[model samples]
Target: MAEQLTGLAGDRVLLGRTSTAERVSDILRSRISEGYFPPGTRLSEDSIGGALGVSRNTLREAFRLLTHERLLIHELNRGVFVRVLTVEDVEDIYRTRSLVECAVVRGLGEPPYPLQGLAAAVAEGERAAVDSDWKALGTANIHFHRELVALAGSERTDELMRSVFAELRLAFHVVDDPRRLHEPYLTRNRELLHTLQAGDRRGAERLLDTYLADSLERVVEVYRRRVGEDGTGAS
Candidate 1:
């Protein structure tokens, strides 16, 4: 875990004048989404503050912000730790994703739909697959979905989906085989992209619905196997 957090070093650059706490929160949040800080790992104030060059108070505020986002949690005696998502959390995430993502595709009101973001994401996913970088592949998958939601042309919905994908990454952190978790989706992402580009909105929506449902079922099964019936794994 220390090594994972270490990779986050130099990834943060403080702007000329910015909210320190919020910047720290954004850095930490990006790390969490990238699987640098895996689920249930305790966050040390001294270590993080020292690493990121932020004061303890700022770090604490950042922790509080992440806690509110459901990415971190505070225990009574123990310090803050990354939130460990459950099977139910997995279900809820997919539920929300299906509604939002499919709608974005299904509700295209104009002939000229934006494909730049989606195309770029799909291309990145293909590149990640070629390199066999499952972790990068996972991040690319999240980006693909974010681009999908961006199709709706609403900042609020995009913000909401960003949080949704962040929470989904929590569950993804426990994946024993990242390749198995993300590789299969690469082709499907391309397929959905093509379907939309071909002007088959209804077909694209159906593919997305099935894609999300299959992914949810697979993720839930793997999560159950990892955490067991009582939600305890080799953490």
Candidate 2:
């Protein structure tokens, strides 16, 4: 099967009429998530295109798309580099995640919405963490929240969280240890599920808010330390 993207566009079936820009954007996004193009790393149009086996035009298009997302930033007279998110950016992301996600869980109470999917996602996160699969864990965590937002009963809401989740994946690049960053939250997630199962929607919402803030701080702390070492990184 072909790969997928979690955006307004969703999973794209590669077909006869797929645009080069879209394909290249998808490929480049995957590479960035896989720890290829890290923060502050410049992209040369021709070079990356040649390496990825795409044309320069396609690569440029991909770069522009990512730039629009704030994942990539352009410098005048220079090339594009992947963004190193600031603590402010981290807080902003958390704020948005909390707003969208907590609101999602607030509406879900006991025995109503099927939470089996979220439970499975939590398990997948743990298994992925144990396997030293940070990438998979990251994806699972995003899926968990994305599904949480799905409870808001709106596709538009789901799409909004999906974009944030994608940027969250990109932010994971600078993380030193995925286990330290995410594994501890598995229990809290389980507990929150139990609370929701018990019809404690308010408690679940509070737990989710705390979880988002704490998790955001953990990663931001790591990001800050790294940026300190480099001196020109995340502010």
Q: RMSD in angstroms, all models?
A: 9.2, 7.6
Q: Where does model 1 exceed 4 Å of error?
A: 1-18
**Model 1 — TM-score against the truth?**
0.88
Q: 88-199, model 1: which lDDT tens digit per residue? A: 8789899999989988888897556788898999899989989988888988999999998998999999888888899999998888998998999999999988988888
Residue pairs with colliding backbones in model 1 are none
Model 2 TM-score, all chains together: 0.79
Model 2 whole-model lDDT (C-alpha atoms): 0.75
What is candidate 2's lDDT per residue for 138-196, written digit by digit as tens? 77777777767877779888767655766776678777787777677777878877887
- The 0-to-1 C-alpha lDDT of every candidate, in the order given, reads 0.87, 0.75
